[model samples]
Target: MDIIRIDDPRDPRVAAYLDIRERDLVGRHGRFVAEGKVVLDVLFSAGRFAVESVLVLENRLAGLESTLRKAAPALPVYVASGEIIDRIAGFHMHRGILAIGNRGAGQPAESLLATLPAGALVVVLVGIANHDNMGSIFRNAAAFGADAVLMDATCCDPLYRKAIRVSVGAALKVPFASFGDAGHITALLDRLGFGQFALSPRGETDIRDAQRTDRLALYLGTEGEGLPEALLSRLRTVRIAMAQGFDSLNVAAASAIALHHFSRGG
Candidate 1:
């Protein structure tokens, strides 16, 4: 692998490489910058996305060239002086090696649903604004073998950098789609014949009490605010049994427990 040296931060070729820090502003196309050795390894092994380029600080990323050569020999790897990289990225240096890849294409909601096996379990999020919670939800959903994930328009992007890192790259593996409105989601699931259950701390029945159905869709809401009142009014509400001393769990933790319960035939 030939190391292409980059001395100027102003180089147009490295613009995408530097744009990673401002991923939120860059919108969908900027979903590619992966940091840390472990994350980079996961990104490369995923094979769902194409490698765009790689940037590294020579002194810090000594043997990474051989690693990249073994994993993606054909991709361009750029080596920059630490100072130049820092200037361009607007931050101090750590995790010397950064790799950029194209965002993998996601299947539409209807397409994903059509491919599901009978008795599928799906998790849906409505108006969840926190990226970390979104990522953790994806991680839990994957761990529990959820058939698919659906997000309402008000929710944060699951592929956002913070969400992706928080999910530990689980977002890359999970099948997910976004719906523009709750009414559309309800109607679509009804059309697909899915039994919809909304998870809320305050509910008439425990999640365990609900009969295990052939097709179940779990609806979760935002952190502090909980599920939107209007949406909750439209779906069956279910709660998790907890000790009398405790009233609630963090949305992510609650999701893990709930998903585990459903996965185990609850």
Candidate 2:
């Protein structure tokens, strides 16, 4: 791998690495910043996102050689002092790793779902705007082997830097597509022949009692508001059945339990 040494933090080649914390909110015109070595590796495996460039602290370059050669061989790997990188990113990013990933024109929800196999297990997320919750759900989804994630329009960008970091790269590996709204997502799942189950504290059945089918899609909503009453009434509902006094689980925690249960048999 060719290493281009950078002394100035303001170099145009490393433009994408500038004031990342602030620019992250301004939008990247389809580009997303990925941090840490693990995330860079996952970005290579994502297939949908292209590795545009890499910026690594000088000391860590030796350890990342193989990964750079294997995954980002064609991309420029710019090396800089830890201090310079920190200045450029506008924070003390101790991980000493960063990469620019091009989030291409992702497939629409319907198209992405159509690509799944016949017995696919999927997660449907509605109004999960919290990046941390979104990330954790992706991690759980990947851990339990869900085929893909379907998100409603209100969901936050799973590619958001913090979310990707929190997922520890699962967000890159798992297939996901955002769509219209709760109603639209459920409609697509139905047309695709998935057995849909919306999780709610007042669910009609306990999670253990819910039957698993060949194609199952578990729906999880934001914590407080939970699933909308209109949407919940349209689908079958199942609850995790916690202690009597504790009626709810954070969306992420609930997802792990739900995914584990559904993934075990179906």
Candidate 3:
């Protein structure tokens, strides 16, 4: 294994790793750092990303070396003292393993829409800012057999650290894209003949009995505000039949239930 010892926090070679602390840095480089052995291992096993580098705390090197040798022998791994890593990253990185990789390019809405078969079920998230919830939604989508995830401009990045971790790496494999405007999404879905169903608490029809048409796009919103009134009016409103005591479920949980129902031919 080729191991480089990095002591200086300002070393140019380690600049990419340091950038993990700054949001602007991630934006400029078009990549984010994934920390912890499990998260890094999950990303590496996917074999879809080119790892720029790996940073391991000196004390943890022995334990992680064998794993890296088998999983990414050709990649460069850097050993840094814990204090140095903390100084560089602006936080205590207890995970001990950090990796830098390129972000995948998102496909156009039209192309994504074209790839799905007729009668397929899709998920669309609008203004969902919580990375944890975003990740959970992605995980559920994959588990329940949803074909794709679409995000509006206001949605959080699913590739963010908290999201990626919360998703248990499902975000890396799921097909997703973001739209600049709701109209762009509506137009594309309209062209593709997808019956848009807005999942709202006040929906007039229960999702179980709602007409199962060819190609359905389920629209979910932020937890606090629910679906936007304007977008709700543009689509067929459908609700999950809930027990009388509860008026709603958390967005992520609701997503899981709705996705499962749709997958079961509800």
Candidate 4:
């Protein structure tokens, strides 16, 4: 492994690791920060995203030696004291491991749709701006064996650090693409012969009763506003059966139920 020793927090070589809390908010162009050993394992194993480099606390390096040797031989592994790492990141990073990775050029939505199998199962999102919800949906998508996740332009970045961590690295495991608005997403899926269903509390069909289709797409919207009435009206709709008083579920929980139901060919 190409291990580089870094004592000074301000070293220019570690630019990507500096002030991460603020940088995460401002975005990192096409790059993302991966935290913790589990997340790093996924980032390295996926081989979909390219590793720029990794930062590790000196004490943590010994435990990760084998993983590093096999997973990232050519990559630079920078070691620092815990204090220095904390200073560099402007926060106490308890996990003691962070990796900088670059996202590959995104596949166009049309191209991704074109390559689906005959019995493809996909999750589509519109206006889902919450990072936690975005991550959970990807986790659910992966768990349920969805072919791909297609998100509208308004959705938050799935590659965002918190989202990636919350997903337990499903963001790396699953295939995804981002595209235009609800109309464009629906039109594309329609042209590709996908039966699309928008999930809503007031949906016409109970999720259990929704018929399975060979090629299916489930559209989930943001919390509070949910899917726009116009868009929901244009597609078949599904609702999870709920208790008497509560009319709705949290978006993430709803996604798990919806994805699970669809996976069972309901």
For model 2, the superposed segments whose C-alpha errors exceed 4 Å read 264-266
Span of ten consecutive residues with least summed lDDT in model 2? 65-74
lDDT of 1: 0.78
Q: In model 2, what lDDT does residue 240 have?
A: 83
The pairs that clash in candidate 1 are none
TM-score of each: 0.84, 0.96, 0.83, 0.94
lDDT for each residue of candidate 4 in 146-195, tens digit (9 for 90 to 100): 99999888899999989999998889878899887678878878988999
TM-score result, candidate 1: 0.84
- Which structure is stronger by TM-score: 1 or 2? 2
lDDT of 2 by residue, 166-197 (tens): 99889988999888867777887898899999
Which residue pairs come into collision in candidate 3?
119-215
Residue runs of model 3 more than 4 Å from their true location after superposition: 24-28, 59-73, 117-119, 210-214, 264-266
Candidate 1 lDDT, 61-164, residue by residue in tens: 67664457445676777889888888767777676777676876666777888888888999989888898899899889878888899988889887777787
Clashes of each: 0, 0, 1, 0
Worst 10 residues of 4 by lDDT: 65-74
Residue 74 in candidate 2, Cα distance off native in Å: 1.2
**Residue 220: error of model 3 in Å?**
0.5
Residue-level lDDT for 247 in candidate 4? 78
Question: What local distance difference test score does each model get?
Answer: 0.78, 0.88, 0.81, 0.88
Better of 3 and 4 by TM-score: 4
Instruction: List model 3 lDDT by residue over 148-238, tens digit each.
Output: 8999889988888778778877776677888888867987897788888889988989988887667888899987898889898888998
For model 2, name the residue pairs that clash: none
Runs of candidate 4 with Cα error greater than 4 angstroms are 264-266
